[model samples]
Target: MISAVAYGWKVTSNAHKNHETEGFKQRAEDVDQKAVNIHVANIICSSIQPLQNRAVLNCIEEKVGPDEKFPWAKFRIEKGFGALEKLLKDHAGRYATGDEVSMADAFLAPQIDAGIKRFNVDMVKFPNFNLENFLCI
Candidate 1:
């Protein structure tokens, strides 16, 4: 995740050069906003991924058995999603951060995809979250 965020910053910086012009100034602002969004998304992903990892799941399954493992994962994910939903609801524009696709979207896309597809999480429960729209973005 750190690598991914670092890559995102590098890519964004290289792509959106801060030239001295009115148009470039606006572009710079957009790039800055994207960096902020990516940082926030990275923070969020860092918080959640640890709880959802194979080792964590294995521990839970060993302690509680296979039948209860799904519930454990679901509970943790839902809790994390609740906090994320609040943040996104307050600040989201078109995607997790804003109108453009940023690092935040990049981080969230695969997580959400896996949560919905692999875990069968009911994403509809998060009314503020637009998974389909975000995925499109």
Candidate 2:
């Protein structure tokens, strides 16, 4: 019988490459509104990343009680879900096959799932945040 470790897959793999392109990147020149949103969201997400990370760290520190720890700065987890969620969403949902399936979608999904479990989020308000979006990439 296989022994259970902690939740979620921890295995590292070069999954993104399967998308058949390196990450999108370019040097800055002009203020494009679309690019600006991407830049802003990343900044926003990074700013609060500390809380969840600290919560993870707190798990190591054993400072807060379990009640606080599980949902510790749960909003941060939610924010991560939101950002990763947007990344998966930007695609037109063409993907629907293969072992790993769409890499970005595969990558974002577990993170989103963890956010849901960790934060107890009510995703209904965000109409765009649908299961179809979740299923597709």
Candidate 3:
């Protein structure tokens, strides 16, 4: 996953010198924002999303039980969300990295939506990670 994300970044970086037009403001020129974007993306891609993926859920259901999958996925998602909230606490504006929509925001929106709609995540627990306005419905 890391390699894939890195490769995409490299390709995007080379192909588009200015990512602002691509909706990835951090990938444009801001180093710190880029770091935040990468970290946030990694958190969701590496740890959070995989927990609910079909393969992992199947494994858990086979090894543990069908009932355990939701709890396991929910726990990991909340934990990852908490980390993201802390990581972006000082940097986030209206979006994940800043006021403008960036790469992190793009990556996060879907995950947040999935957590709510698919996983039944209780957004009320994550007060700071509220992305209601950022979601496109």
lDDT of 1 by residue, 1-137 (tens): 55544554555455456432232121225656655565556555666555567888899899999999878787787777777777677657666766555556656666677678757788888766667676673
What are the lDDT figures for the candidates, one per model? 0.64, 0.41, 0.73
lDDT of 2 by residue, 1-137 (tens): 32111111111123222323344212122244234334433433353334445446577348767666655566556665565445434532333111223333333444445456655666653343445656443
Q: Please give the ranking of all candidate structures by lDDT, highest first, separated by commas.
A: 3, 1, 2
**Per-residue lDDT of 1-137 in model 3, one digit per residue for the tens?**
55444554564455446545544454525788878878988898887777767888898788879998788788888899889888988888777777776667656776788888878988777665656755761
Which has the greatest lDDT?
3
Off by over 4 Å in 3: 1-16, 22-28
Per-prediction TM-score, please? Answer: 0.69, 0.43, 0.80
Per-residue lDDT, model 2, residue 120, is 69
- Summing lDDT over every window of 10 consecutive residues in candidate 3, give the lowest-scoring window: 19-28
Quick one: ranking by TM-score, best first? 3, 1, 2
Candidate 2 Cα outliers beyond 4 Å, as residue runs: 1-61, 85-101, 133-137
